[model samples]
Target: MNISWEEIELYLRHTFVTARESKKNVKRVIVKLEDDGFYGLGEAAPSPRYSESVETVKNFLNEFNKLISENMSLYTTLQMLNNLNGNYSAKSAVDIALYDLHTKKLNLPLWQYFGLTSDKIINTSFTIGIDTTENIERKLDEAHEFKVLKIKLGCEDDIKIIQTIRRYTDKPLRIDVNEGWKNLNKAIELIKYLEDNNIELIEQPLPSEMLYENNRLREQTTIPIFADENCKTFEDLILVKDYFDGINIKLSKCGGIFNAYLMIQVARYLNLKIMLGCMIESSIGISAAAQLASMVDYIDLDGNLLINNDPYTGVICKEGELKLINEPGIGVMKIEK
Candidate 1:
């Protein structure tokens, strides 16, 4: 068995700003696993908020290589991953590669291997990052195929941002505050105003640590609230299940497909709506996230779509719809330079 990784730069089509930071270029690590003349690919888009960076992911993978033995079963591999604390992005890269390798060996696309109907996949929302009204309109012009839009809020001009977007298209809107709002009363009032518009859902209106405030806001607002920063692993779900109507599951946040599958099952058991999401990454990472799209109520796998240079291709996003091609093992192919 052989394991290696490379750092790559991903430039967003537009400036991506949240309450935390502004991002123009994102650095990611691409992991490749090779054995018996076959190779599996994975990617890790580390988030600083989680204390993960390209350097951390690379170091973690180096340590992970020492744990690999000959012909290791997937179950044992996952157990090994669980033993390691933190570095969810690193674990996700390895987990995705193992699954990709397993599915390829079986000659089945990931969706088919999971017994998921491709048609069950829903439309993915294109995101409009925080920016000026003119920039927002220009971004919308570029997003012709996307019928649904996810807008970033939590600024002083939150209302103006929604109003600006509404002036152009009546498309369904979703808002992610990224733990931006601090006041519960003000959050509820803004949520009500957004509900009166065409907003479909609101995500993480308050700080993640404000569990009581989030629960209160959930009880007061008429719109559905999805938890992003508040919910990471299944344990976090236990704490937030009563507060949030749904959860946004990112492979990086949950560790990988193995845990993400379990998260979906637990979310279902709790009767919570599921949303599959991703960070700014190339097709390799977005495609891995898309493999689970059939199991979720909504998807935001357009991270690859917002990039100019995607080094891999797998899932195709056409006019807001996600389509998986007939290929084995996550159905991803590396583009030859």
Candidate 2:
């Protein structure tokens, strides 16, 4: 197998702000794997929140190249990833590429390989990043076609922000506090206000470490709470099953599709709902995540949609519904620059 990679910057259409930080653009590493004349593609959108960056991903890939050979199987590669420390995003890039290469060799779509169907896939939520009230209105207008909208909160003026958003439209809304809220009482109070509004769900209201606070807050609110930062891998799910109602599984954060696939089974056994998510990535990563959309309860795979320049095209989302293509593997094609 031949492995190669290059760093690319993706400009966001809007300033993507979360409680932790803000970003106008993001750096990503596009990884390629070639074996027996078949090529597979993947992307690594490393997040600083996870102590990962472009430099870290690149360094991990360099070490990764020395660990495997042409005779290694996909299972072997996945098992090897467990031995490596951290760098889930970097491991995810190689993990996705291997799955793509393996699936293509068998001439089967990724979902088909897992004995899943696209019919159960739900519409994704278009994110409205944290911005000024005026900018929020503009974002809302632009997302008119989308059936659901995810509002990013965690600022000092969260109530004012949601109020500003409610004035614009009454579309179904999901709130992502990004672990912004601190006090359990305060989170409970905010939940009351969100409940009166069109909020369908709340994500990470308190900090990731506040497991007891989250469980207490969950008991007070009727709305379901989905864990994002708190739930990174299958192991994290076990720890957070009693804390959150559902888990937001992002491939980059969880280490790849295979890991995410295993997570779905474990989450179900733990009686937790599943929400498939992604970073601010191109279609290569988003499409790879979408292949497992059929197994998730909610979809937040709109990372590619938020970007202005996506180098690859796959898994078209029309009015929020992700249309998974029938092509072999993860069904993505690079666009010529």
**Candidate 1, residues 77-128: lDDT per residue as tens digits?**
8899889999999999998888888788788888788887777747999998
lDDT for predicted candidate 2 compared with the true structure: 0.90
Judged by lDDT, which candidate is best?
2
lDDT of 1 at 170: 94
TM-score of each: 0.98, 0.97
- Supply the TM-score for candidate 2: 0.97
Per-residue lDDT over 210-248 for candidate 2, one digit per residue giving the tens place of the 0 to 100 score: 988888888887899999999997789878887889889
Model 2: colliding residue pairs: none
The CA lDDT of each predicted structure is 0.88, 0.90
* Candidate 2 C-alpha error for residue 142, in Å: 0.4
